[model samples]
Target: MPPQRPAPSARFTPPSRVRAAAFGLLGTVALVAFGLRIGDVAFVDEYAYISQSYYADLFLTGEWNDPAWLDFPGYDLMPLPKYLIGTALRVSNEPRPGPAAARMWYANTHSTFGTPRTLTSARVPSILVGGLGCLALAAIGAMAFDFRVGIAAGVLLMLNPLYALHAHRAMSEAPCEAFLMASLALALAAWRRSFAGRASGFRILGLLAGAGVAAALAVLAKFNGLLALMTIAAWAGLAWAIPRGAGWGWLWFATGSALAAVTAGLAFMALNPYMTARDPVYRVADPADAGPLRPGPLGAWGRFRLLIDHRRAMSAGQQRIFPHNALKRLPERAKVVAVQGFGRFGPFGPATSDSTIRYDMRQDRGAFAWLPLCLGAMGYAMAYGRMQSRRREPPAAWAVAAWALVSLTVVTLYLPMAWDRYLLPIQAPFSLLAAAAIVGAWDALARLAGWKPRLEPS
Candidate 1:
């Protein structure tokens, strides 16, 4: 006899309830993990933002910017949070508001706390975002495959100390990643509904709008978000092309996508006024500085140059270049002098650890722990083959696979500089793929071993 199947009611239990419970547990775990890092207070970028907050206040109070603050060339990449914190401090008007307020406030109040803001508060946003990101990953997995996959992905993400470390710091990466995952999840959900022939016009519009807002926020959080947007767009186009007929679905998809693009563009324009005022000559030097760069065509070269220029401009303000005379013998020293680029060479040899766990502990590390990742990659290949053979894959799965591949290729080819934080945003999807492979491999092994399958009442 064929294997007995579970009851319909068993499969019909509300997925939303399961997701909420899983998210609650994941959030609790993340909070506990973050609390352990609460004493860490050595972030390098904290002081810089504090200074920016003070200047922003000066601009607000009419003490600076005789020209309108909007006209100033300053690039305050930080969005509402930074300014809101500063405004809060100004409103409190405490004689000595404290470091938290000082960092958030317009004035220097570091001395009052006798310490900087506790790591907990400084890192609260990261922790929250990271936790949400984990939940989002789980949701994506559940939507794509099943609850098992979602739970497994969420657990893996929660345990990944590299993510945990970043989440406990006052950085934008965690939040950006969270938004990216959330946007992707929403898009996938909508796509699934559309595929099932249940999509309403308003629902589709809302998905696109949410995606646009998320993508824009991701860009505002960090420039890497453009990669996420491009990935989604390519997936959408492929979906449109492969369908049997050019129906109203494609029309709705196109309209929604166009609106999303417009929204992202407007957000970029609103936040990056510098793009408008920037001299064309200065902007032309680096292709990465213009907008987003994709790998496909030579046309992307212009955008790559703009990206490079943006990096150069930002790094110039952050780093102090050594005099060329100090490195007379180095062959490429002239290039460094000309472009003000600094090279980092280490005597300790190459970093080769998986995840940022070791890096957070001040140890040398690489992108991820190599062995598990390699195994995971192999597993993904197997899963891909299985899905192809069975024809059971969802459209979003293909999109995610393509996104991961393209993003990885671009980052590897164009930006060889490996920073642990750079990998955070992609970690969610990567982890899910990895987990899928692992689960698939285990199932295969169980079958090979002739293990009896668990039976559920019909």
Candidate 2:
């Protein structure tokens, strides 16, 4: 018996018109999804992100109108979005100085029953960035699988209850993952073009450069943005190990990682002055209690280690405070992953428990639950099957499987508690796979009816 060579996936590529229609529909969904949620203030974490971005600006510029502005309660994550979100709020005329900003935060969150202009402005960046994420996911689906999968996945992501409620908040989820998705999308497209001999060496190198920059920006957006690099690196490492018909060597994947590392290092220093800015001896609270704490500029390597340390401290604190939320055991972790990723009830409020589940369903639950997950399973099965077969398959198809699996496994294993938004790492890939399932069914129905749209190859 001879080994079976897998069929190339370029045959599945939809024509220009179908591709355009898919993108157009996805764009509309992404925009509408973002527009509806830009005004939301239901999530409490929103308070910190806007305030931190505000404080980051003040600290960097040395523009302290009030002494209180020096108390820049820094973010536990990366530094890029501080500038991005701050710039947005500033352009929208967010209240400046320490007290007014504090008052605004307090008014909108704790005491006041009214929505503020600043809250909406603070969230605009998230909404815009999240919208980009939706479109990017759709692109990943179309390029990796089919237009049906791509469109369905994008719509599901845009409208998912957990994604809608948190992904567009003035926080870390959307900005980081969107850029990561872009990097993966670029990698998929480049891999296909290179395999087909449609791209020159220079063009291929350019694509790699773009993917690297996007990956770098993703990391700067958030630390977990490493998922993008990790996915590419994994596929690169595995691609060589697997017996295949034809594809680029794993060295290109190595180049991507190197490029991302270099770009992140350069961009970190360039975009965030805080990396080199001096920190004055400032006490956390009362000047009398404890001593003044000081640290030098968090240079390239230091920042990543510092982030890890901060997260470790956070985990320790969480264990003590939120005793019931720890995922120390396998079953415990599995249950949380299922709830946060597939099920409805999840960690909300200032705490990581659903007891504070005043989070309204009509406002938040915009996506289907069991159906998408089931479809994603079927879709992912097909992708994995293609990769396993001896025949040629799109790198993006295999890469999506790798991305989702790695991310989901990491989340399942490493996530300290059951926070819904932590599922951001795995959501994009899953959504695309779910779309694949739907597309499979649609195509079957079209074939049966003898009126399937003519899907010519590119």
What C-alpha lDDT values do all the predictions have? 0.52, 0.62
Q: Write the per-residue lDDT of candidate 2 for residues 1-458, one digit (tens) a residue.
A: 33234454433666679778778877777777677866654567666566556555664576543233223234354556666667776787665334344445544544221247766766777777777888888887777766667777888777666666655677777788888888878777665554432235455556767777888778777777888777866766655565544434444545655665576567655554445554465335554322123234445467456656767787878767777666567777766566445545211212122623323343224224553555466566556546534345445566666777888788888777655666667666776766666676677797899976665443
Q: Which structure among the candidates has the greatest lDDT?
A: 2
Q: Model 2 Cα displacement at 269 (Å)?
A: 3.4
Against the true structure, whose TM-score is highest? 2
Residue by residue across 1-458, what tens digits does model 1's lDDT show? 22122113211124567657867887788768766775675555544343334433543554432221222113334442334334544555512232234333223324223135532344556667778888888887766655666777877777665566666665666767777778778766665544433337677768877877777777756666777577667767755764432235545666677777778767655543333332322212124222232212222234335545756564443333423222223333322211211111111113223322212323332223433463465457545534532442334455556666656544443332234454444456666766666665666697799974453221
Note the clash tally of each candidate. Answer: 20, 5
The TM-score measured for candidate 1 stands at: 0.67
Which residue pairs overlap in candidate 2's backbone? 5-391, 6-390, 6-391, 6-392, 149-435
Q: Residue 270 of candidate 1: its Cα lDDT?
A: 54
How does model 2 score by TM-score? 0.80
